[model samples]
Target chain A: MSMYVDMILGGVFHAAVVFLVAAGLQLVFGVQKIVNLACGSFYALGAYFGITAVAGAAAMGLPSVVVLPVLLAAGLAIGLIGLPVERLLRTVYRRDESHQLLLTFGLLLVFQDVMRFLWGPTPLTLDNAYLAYGTAEFAGVRVPTYNLLVIAASIAIAAGLGLFLQRTRTGRIIRATAENREMSEGLGVNSNRVFAAVFTVGCMLGTVGGALVVPASAASLEMSVELVVEAFAVVVIGGLGSMRGAMAGALIVGLIRAVAIMVLPEAEILSIYVVVIAVLILRPAGLFGKAMA
Target chain B: MNLNRRSVLRGIGAAGLSASMPGVFAPAIAQSKPVRIGILAPRSGAMGTVGECGIRAVQWAADRMNKDGGIAGRPVELVFEEETSPKDTIERFRRLVLQEKVDCVQGLISTGVSMGVAPVAEEEQALLIMWDGTTQDGVKEAMPDARYVFRSTDNECEAVMSSLLSVKYFGNKIKRVAGINPDYSYGRNNWEAFRQILTRAGVQYEVVAEQWPKVGTMDLTSHIAALKAAKPDFIFSSMLFADLPVFMKQGSAAGLFEGVNLALPAAGWQLNQLKKSFMPENIVFGHNTLYFALPDASPLQKAFVEDYMERYQQAPHWEADRAYFALAAYKAGTEAAAKATGRWPKLDEIIDAIPRQEVQSLGGPGRFRADKIAEQVFYQGLSTNDNAYDFPTLRTVNAYTADQLQKPPGMDFWEWLKTAKLPV
Candidate 1:
């Protein structure tokens, strides 16, 4: 019974990481109608920066409490990188969607190679700060404080973004653009600026996701494709552009994977694909997505 | 726009004269052509960097060979072909054989890639040298006609049995065993082998839990959690590359290693790579054949290590040692073949002469088996600090001979697999 509770808690933690990445992917795809394959690259970059910052801080005799903020700052810096890329992407807005897809794919390869050149072909690990000082008991199961922190941060980020989108003028403008870009442009919304802003936010969220998971894992040159493909599956199954849908999708995938590991270990490899195929067959537009007329 | 009849006639005469002189054209053609060795491996996909190391090792070997007066007194050249996807491996292999006209082909990091290229090599009658790919079915599948295919690395079954032997050495101190491996052939085979060996050894193993994350998985927290929940006394992790470090970091942070003994067969080579990232004391490390780097105190091993470090500016991994030994085997086989036939023999003739061919390797002596896989002796070692060496090195604890380590021929793999019953 305790083992079962631990597995569920573990599943929730895994879901949180997936939600952070999928939320950003869903947002970018929802508003811009562009599948930003480079989100994976940005995620990897964020983790790299996070690990470097933590190592650099420790080298400089900084307290461990400063690590999380340093990681967040690194994530924001990666978000700033999206500003220039978003501007470049704007130039090709009038081109076919395939052009954007190809550009992002090219960026993915370029970023991965650039990282390889900078960091060499070795994996780097960040020391455990969260586990050193934090622990919590839930449902008679002992869980890492870091896992709880990730879950809380994910919820806070999701709720914070949800509220901002629901009540803020800029958020409404982004949503309006997502609904119909032509209509938003018709209303003098400066759709290009809106696209850039949405892209920046999306990239920031992805970076934060990477930053959040860095302490638990090392940053490597190979993380780009694995993260991006999984993120794509999450957003597609959650509803292409819905934050709520992304969270739901991430949880579903995460839970399915965790359950599969316990109940059917042999089938764990195909668990995600099985879920994605079932969801697609049942609802082509996803769980929360509206079908295009 | 101005043309002269005399000039046109002179041009035609010159062309005719050059065409008629075959001796004049000989130097030009000979200078342009060089003996080419083709390299094929994944360079941009899941197994990219691992493949990159194999490619680098081959290039380094070819360079060293060329520096030593080349093969047969002619310059050796290398032509690399990158296979980005499994779907394109067969076609790319065909192109290397039919168009590139390579003398030898090497480099495969995954079993899938090896299986894909075996038929192509067989069809073209090209000599295929496999560096680091393992599929148990490969030897039987390529039998009778696929004599040109040869492997230099240990198979999955050998690796699994090696890990189990290490577990046995640890003995009753280990209470339970868990596995964290990728859900592919390599991972599955390792798990199956470990389970079979453990059951046969009369060791109690409750799989408590197993995690089979997708290949190339970046995050392994959930898998780590599953492992922790099992609360096994030891773990046999088959995760490679990025996932390996990720799991190690997470496991370290979660205090999962506090009371656990961890044995990772694939991570022995990676210990040096991650030395700067993680503390060596925080985790227990064990692997198969600590390679030439083991604390052997042999003159030959010392010379090889010192020379490799001096030349490459970094310590040599198992891949480098294996590459050097493979070349050495080739040299020994070729000499034996030459001695027997009194002439330079073809690849088959050379291979046939390699059954009992002996060569002094960085890791002692090695020979070829009936399956075409090299029978290199391996030793299990524990990580230990040596005052003699600046860096940490593996201290040999157990040496398993080739006969003891590997399964005998003609034994059914399934019959071996039937021993994996759980201790209920």
Candidate 2:
């Protein structure tokens, strides 16, 4: 029973990182009508910024009370850089998506090389926060406290985003803009502002996801490239532009991977790809996604 | 001073030109052509971090040897190529040897690349020294016919045999064993050899869990929990490179490695760089093909480590030692062959230089056998960060020697394992 609990917890922890990154990509596609290929760079940036910020905060002899808030502040500041990135992206909004994709793909390479130039190829370690709380026992099985926080934080973000979309005026306006941009503008919703605001929030969520995972897993050059592929898979399997799809798809992939590690071990990665292919064949609209018609 | 690729070529070109021009440059013409060595290493990819170390070792050995009067007064010239995969290796190797006309070639730490490059070098008749190819298939099955290919690192068989120290130390505790390795040829080979060793040791060992995650796998959460549930007394791991820290961090957090004896055959030497405060104790840092330190280790090993520190301001990675060992074998073989032939040794002569001969190495004295792979002995050590150095260092955890860890003569490795009594 404890082993099962541990496996489920492991699945949740694994899913948390993927869902958070994919949800933003889904949300941005809803408002902007464009898939940002460079979203992976934002995720990598978050990890790099997170470790640097966390270390800087600790080095300043700041109280531990400021740690969580400081990490949040660093994450929010990173989203602001997306404004200029979006402005560069604005040029391709009216143009073909291939242009936006090519431009963003170029940005991804540039960001990767720039980070490599600064940090070199060595992996960065800032596992201090991850080690701070130590392990918590649940029914005789040891659970990493950092993993629990990641699980809870992902749930909180998902629930909060769902509520914001359903209950808040700004979110409703954004949703209306997503459905019909010109009609929302005709209804005086200010469509451009919605696009900018949606893209920013999505970027923040993606960045936070990366920031949270870096404390446990060391920040690596390969992390962004791998996450980008998984994020696309999760979003594609869930439903493009659907937050619920992102959540559902992440859990399914995560659980399958977790189970595979226990049962076959060799099929851990292969299992995830198999489900995505099966889902695409059966339901192209994804689990929570609505059909185009 | 360091010589880049262009300058070394320019010097060679000048020497070649001077040889033709008679009177003015006749003294330079009398000097034999530089014995050029081509180095194929990854400088831009994922393995570049360690690959560059091999390149640096080549240059360091070249400079030091050249200053000390190079082999038979023929100045050694080293050329470096950034190579990644087997295809990349073949392409860069062609350019290095066919176009540049290098006398010899040294390659990356990957076994796959070495397997591909072996036949190419043999067909071209260029001596190929692999700095770090630890895969058993390279010598045993992959390129057995290729006489020119050589390596100094311990292959999969010797690596597993070295873990016998851990078994003897733990005694009855090793009744149940688990293996956590990457689901690839390298890791599979490690497990097969380890399992065979345990079976032959006459131990009633039952494999509790066998976890083989795909290459570049990041998460090992459920894998850890499952292993912890198995409650195995020992876990043999072949996980390495960037995947290590993630395993160490998450595996340690789940208390997977706590109180249980662990063996990281591939990347155990890297444990010294990790912090002692967070690291798992009792990790059997099994002697890799060439670890820097050994109990009653060779004097040449001490000189090599000190030389690396003096030059690079840090302790050398084990890959650097392998690179240095390749150079040492080349130096010994080339000098011996040159003395016998009374000129620069030919490609075939270099291949036949030190067969069945032993020479000094980074870890100790290693033998260049008939198969062309330099067979070195193994010794076990413990993982610790707070030892004698700033980074993680071993404290000579065990008292076992090469004879105890190695497969003795007059029998096959498996045959000897089945019959021979292990020395404790």
Candidate 3:
């Protein structure tokens, strides 16, 4: 029973990390009708920034708690950088969706090579936080405390975003714009502003995801492609642009991955792809996604 | 546009006269056509860092040779080809041989990549000096002719045998052993080697538990728990790089290492770096090369260590050092062969020259084995406190000779299995 609890907790933590990045992808695809493949690049950059900040703080003999604020700050910084790109993307809003994807794919390559130029080609570990705070026992199972913190932070962000989207006028206006871009423009809505805002928010989510996972995993050059693929898989499985779907999809993917690691270690590598394919076959639009027709 | 034909002919005659000058093209080619050596390894993937380091060492050796008047006055030119995956290795090898026409090829980090390019090297009749990645069957089965392919890295059999020797160091203290390795050919081969060596050593070992974690497993909590529950005297791990440190960190946090002795065969390079961060204790590990920082009272070792430290800003790992030595041996072999034949020797002549030739390595003198592998020695050391150095260093306890560790050629599998025994 405890083993099952540990696995569930592990699954939840892993889901939360994926959710932080995939939520933004959901929002961008929901509003813009374009697939931003570069969300993974932002996640990787955010993680790299957080690692450098945490490493710098540690070198100056700062406490491990500094990593949290560093992560948030790095996420926001990446979010701000995404603002200009989001503006540029507005020009291609009327273009074909594939054009946006190709542009973002090019950005992904650029960011990946830029990361390699900065961090070299080896994996860097952030075991310092894990080593210092140590493991926390939950239900007789040892879990890294940083992982729990990641879950808590992810929940807070999700709730905050949900409240903002539901309760705020600007948030509703952005949603109104996403519902029908031409209608929102007809009703005197600044569609360009909405697009830029949503894109920035999406990038922020990805950056936060990257920053959060750094304490658990290292920031590698490969993370851009790996994280983006997983994020896209989560977003697609959750329903493109559906927050509830993204959450459910992340949990399913994370649980499946963890369970696969336990039950089928050899097949663990293909577990994610298998899950995505199965989910797609069962529900073409995803669990919580609305049908296009 | 309106120039006359006579003026155009005069211009062409002038260009031809310049082309016919004494030292224009022919003498320039004759004076400085160096032996081109091609290096193929991944430079932009997961294993790029180590691959880049190996290439750097190869280039360093090539530069050093050219500075010392080259091999028989023909300079050695080093060409590096980056391969992103195993699929690219064969294509790149062919390009190097047929197009670039390199005299020799060297440096591969992946066993799959080495095996992929081995047949091409044989078919092309070019010498391939493999600096890393050794599989007992892959090396022998793929390159049975053994005329062109030579491995400098210790084979998996020798690595496992070295780890088994450490079991005897613990003696009856280590009663049982568990194995944790990546679930691949390398992992399975290492586990088999360790089991065979243990059985031949006459030491009783229970199959308490084994965990063949998927390659690149980031989380090791469950595997650590499984190993802890078994409570073997020691654990033999074939995990390398990121997986190695992840397992060690989780194992330490879970208190798995508190009661158990850990024996890792491939824990040489990165674990040493992780020691400063993790402070690993009470573990007896085996590496192909140990005490790499110590000069062993040899000028060659001292010079190489000092130069490496100055260049890389860190101590040279066994991988880096072995590659340096392999390149040095290649130079030495070429020099000897060229002197005897008065021309660039063929693959067979180079292989023959390697065994008869010796070169000063960072570890000591390295020659060729009858099995066509590097006749290198192995050492087992304990990680002890170093009051003088910045980091903890390995103190040598045992040194195994190449002859004792190597299996003789022409021995069948059954005969080799019967003769295989752990040296204590």
Candidate with the greatest DockQ versus the true structure: 2
lDDT, ranked from best to worst: 2, 3, 1
Q: Which candidate would rank higher by lDDT, 1 or 2? A: 2
Model 2 lDDT per residue over A44-157, tens place: 778878878988889899865465566667777786767777778888899988888899888887777766676665567665566666789877778988788778888998
iRMSD per prediction, in order: 6.7, 3.7, 6.1
lDDT of each: 0.66, 0.71, 0.69
Q: In candidate 3, what are the lDDT values of residues B1-424, reduced to their tens digit?
A: 1111001111111112222323212232323556677777556555655665666666666666555555555566766676555667788788788888887887787787777777777788888887775434632444545678887644564455555565566655667788888887778767777776766767677767677886555556556655655668778787765667667766666556766776666666554344444545445655565345553536766766678778777666556656776677787886677667766666677778876777776666677765667766666556555545444466555666565665655554334655765466
Candidate 1: count of backbone clashes, pairs at least 3 residues apart or interchain:
0
Candidate with best lDDT = 2
lDDT of 1: 0.66
TM-score of chain A of each: 0.95, 0.95, 0.94
Native A-B interface contacts kept, per candidate: 0.30, 0.50, 0.17
Question: Residues B1-424, candidate 1, lDDT per residue (tens digit)?
Answer: 0111001111111212222323212332312234466667555444555555445555555555454434433344666676545567777677778887776676666667777787778778887766665434633333433477776545553455455555556655656888887787677777777776666666766776677877656556566667777788878777766667666656665557767776666665554444422334322343343354665635756766676667655565555445555555665665566556655567788778766687666566777676776666565555555434433355545555455555455555546445433221
Which sequence of candidate numbers ranks them by DockQ, best first?
Answer: 2, 1, 3
- Cα error of candidate 3 at position B155, Å: 3.8
* Model 3 regions more than 4 Å off: A59-61, A270-274, B1-31, B134-140, B170-178, B202-214, B217-233, B254-256, B295-297, B342-348, B385-392, B410-418
lDDT of each residue in A1-293, candidate 1, tens digit only: 87677667767887888787788788888888888889898888888878877778888998887766777787778777788889888866778999989999988888877776666545565645545436677777666677777788889989999998989999899999988899999999998889888888888888888887777666777777778877877876888888888998888878877777777777755888887898789997889887866
Off by over 4 Å in 2: A61-72, A98-100, A127-129, A187-193, B1-34, B44-46, B134-140, B152-154, B293-300, B307-314, B354-357, B384-392, B397-424
Provide DockQ values for all models, in the order shown: 0.30, 0.46, 0.29
Docking band of candidate 3? acceptable
